[model samples]
Target chain A: MDIPSHITIKEVGPRDGLQNEKVILSTKEKIAWINRLSQTGLSYIEVTSFVPAKWIPALADALEVASTIERKKGVTYAALVPNIYGLERALQANIDEINVFVSSSETHNKRNVNKSISDTLDVIKEVADQSLFTGRKVRGYVSTIFGCPYEGKINLDKIKKIIDSLLNMGIYEISLGDTIGIANPLQVEHTLEELKKSFPLSIFAMHFHNTYGRGLANILVSLQQGITTYDSSFGGLGGCPYAAGASGNVATNDLVNMLHTMHVQTGIDERALTLARRIIDDKLGKRFSSHLLQIKNEQVKK
Target chain B: MDIPSHITIKEVGPRDGLQNEKVILSTKEKIAWINRLSQTGLSYIEVTSFVPAKWIPALADALEVASTIERKKGVTYAALVPNIYGLERALQANIDEINVFVSSSETHNKRNVNKSISDTLDVIKEVADQSLFTGRKVRGYVSTIFGCPYEGKINLDKIKKIIDSLLNMGIYEISLGDTIGIANPLQVEHTLEELKKSFPLSIFAMHFHNTYGRGLANILVSLQQGITTYDSSFGGLGGCPYAAGASGNVATNDLVNMLHTMHVQTGIDERALTLARRIIDDKLGKRFSSHLLQIKNEQVKK
Candidate 1:
């Protein structure tokens, strides 16, 4: 019942979404999709990740995408920067915001980035400091905060420590990731309650996956807990590469629709979001996982 | 969070689920699926609808299925009875409970049952009386409580009047249905708050569809308002017959999985529900709308 009147939706379809996909979009296609996303009234868009081509070939055109997207005024264009080299590339591309991520679980952290949690933090510290020095705001992503596929339930203490480190390194916000999409509403409430005791809730964002159809439910609890910022993908694109059964991030269209229906202002144009989804759908030639997309498809059939 | 520690799930997959499908299951297959559902610890199952064969050929074998399923001792096998004639057949099938449904919107009621709201309630009144006189408890379903495809936003006063009429007719519990899957959490919270002012929350259940993927989110708000009973279908099976682009009911597997994860007991086995879904999947040869099914498919591929 205690929901925010307005919320911020950070579109992550281009980076987090396309990274896990098999089909590689041309640099021009990626730029076109981001341009479409920019017109959707989303204030923030993560356009691409600067990870190496060997790590995520689908997003290997990260520099091209980051540099070529038509950056709309008042919109923050972000790119994921894994280390100093990635940060250099993102900086060269003039990304508006730099996002660095590390997994909360040791096993998942090692498997994802070939580094321990501590080592990942060390790299993130350098990236955050460098980005801050360059007058660019940096956001931190703490993955597997809810549950890790290999290690199962993550420790809250570990998540707290990682968040603390990120905040100490001049990171402006920390996005908590449910990498395996195993979080329930109660778990989200408890975690947020604990985190709120340590830091202001405004400094945190919820990044959920809709694997078991609990993404919106989790978001509902987060809203009740005063979380206003959420990270979602267009048409529910992307899945965890390391977690076998993990699904994509929660769909941006579904999130915006729910928010608007509930009278929670998201400032998003649902019609425009669909247009962005169409761009990706055309390039990938695959069906998406979003319920809104299914409804649209049904309407088209009729 | 004020969430209930224990909840009741009324399984509607066999009746509401199959009735909307293009592929009609044989009576034997329906009975087998119901028997499998009985093993999953569901205390209530709406097995079939006793409508005229001309109206719903998919459920033409209703009496055969209702009578032949291997009913577990603690489970209440129920059936949908539209009129006195349907009630007679349901009584003959020895169903434990009778469910009567009417749409809150006038146009949907006319389109679905070819009768005015008043006339449909008149029929429901007679059906309820006969079923109660026969010593069978009757439940009521009020569809399109959230929004109607034909009428758009439904009037709460109209819904309240319909619910009052049904309760006056000896209907024990009323299941509030989002027939078009248009309800959001705030709407759910507001509606339940208003309804609780007139009736005890104990006498109401929430029935939601996943058309826009807001089902679980809506359920979260309902739970916060002390709604402990829900109607769900295995594998998200059914869609509204008259509502264009409506998706299936909120999946029982996803519902039970979330409840169990949140430590809210429904006494339902997730694995057993999956087994029951397999039966329907084999019979229909189609993928379901439930996220749990998608996750299972992903796991199987791995």
Candidate 2:
């Protein structure tokens, strides 16, 4: 199978990861971690989410984190914005890139955002247009594209419509998320095959979860499908708390390790990434999931 | 990439999984677990090892386990034998299949078995001859085929030589083991491409560890190479105790889940395998390393 020569990794640890974690990091702690992550040579770092404090108190200081971090020269410090208000907050904070998400499955869209798919699309259209018009890159996330907890087996037609809407709204890239980690390689291949025919490969990214231990396998197939951008979290942190069996996003460490070994350049510094992982994982007072990180740390102790 | 329509999984949990574990299951516990596994529809199960008690105190009751479990009609109960003495014990217990192992790297071979590769080969030649003459199948395992703890990269020439020697000595099949789990897809593809030039794919199996979290990805590539047989431990148990950072073997649960999703049949019952996993993992008083098994169990609890 043909694979990409190099891949871009968008690290979502600070935002997607911390939001699901029960242990809340203070503004200072989040800034420290994001700054450390910036030095890891990651091109994109999703710093925080600009959601309302009551909804996600964990990232209540998103504006502070966006303003505090000493952003690196080549890194794009990004933030998640749920609506026009969130996008306005991100703009004030001078976020490098703005991310907006909607679920492809109608049931998930209603459950997650309290809106219908069409309603969510309208909000995304406003958010995407404003972000792009303000000279900021807009990345769209289509959650539950593979399967849904509330509604299993998402249809391909839904994915295509969502992608077309996001692209027409000027979203620079769309991340197809396996929200519940219910995807298998065959399902992933089939989905990508259909999606690729409908969209340019340059505007696609894969966001997978390790909920079923199929994260890397899915990524491997995505690589063969000529996908060059992937969304991941450091130490594999971030999973929906409501999703009973779901784990974190595919660990950034594991993804980079596999890519490097396969001769696919990711331009990530392993040592710096581990240091950032240690800082956050230690602060959380728990071992975050990431097999490569865990094993390497264990060896160091030995 | 064409995948095989069906695959054979040789469950190595009882022997390899328990051997490396710190917790010791009593003879009765082992028998109970083995009996549960027999009903899982696995065509082959490596029950226990007949090595010296000092070498593996965990499997000291290998003879009793081999004799006690009510072996199912379709499953072949297998055992690991380190030398002629272990082979004799296996013979007395009427083990259906015998497994012998050596390392592709000389340092690892010496460290693992305290014998040179040539000397190990001589012993394996004897064991294979006797087992075949007695109408039993012999499976040879070439450990550290991809990477070694003491020696990082192993030569492909060494792998070819070992396979040739085993085949000539009447070994029915040879398993290429990534003992330290340092395999990548490109390297696996390259190694398999070179080896297949001299050997038939029918006599080969892939045994991978999840040390680097690349187990399933490696397995995916191997499946595409037409390898139908794989060795895995349930709950992802079994790692080299001597290798400092080695994790468990690829979990049988994860392997079957991936294979079945890819439309490849393994003829194993997921529910039954999970039942067997619960029995052994609860007895060990720790969650074993299979991500899929752990997540499912956690969901059931919720």
User: Tens-digit lDDT track for model 1 on B54-145?
Assistant: 99999999988888888789999999998989988998999999999999999999988999999999999899888889899999999999
* DockQ of predictions, in order shown: 0.68, 0.64
Question: What are the per-residue Cα lDDT tens digits for candidate 2 across A162-200?
Answer: 889888888889999998887888888888888778777
Please write out the lDDT profile of model 2 over residues B101-143, one tens digit for every residue.
Answer: 9899999889878999999999998898889899998999999
lDDT of 1 by residue, A1-302 (tens): 78889999999988888887777778888888889888989999999999999998888888888888888998999999999999999999999999999999899889889999898899888888889999999999999888998998888987898999999999989999988788999999999999989999999999999988899999999999999899999888887665554558998989999999888999888898877766766665354777788667666668
Q: What is the interface RMSD of each candidate, in Å?
A: 2.1, 2.1
Candidate 2 CAPRI grade:
medium
Instruction: For candidate 2, list the clashing residue pairs, or say none.
Output: none
lDDT of 1 at B184: 93
Q: Which ten residues in a row have the lowest lDDT in candidate 1 chain A?
A: A278-287
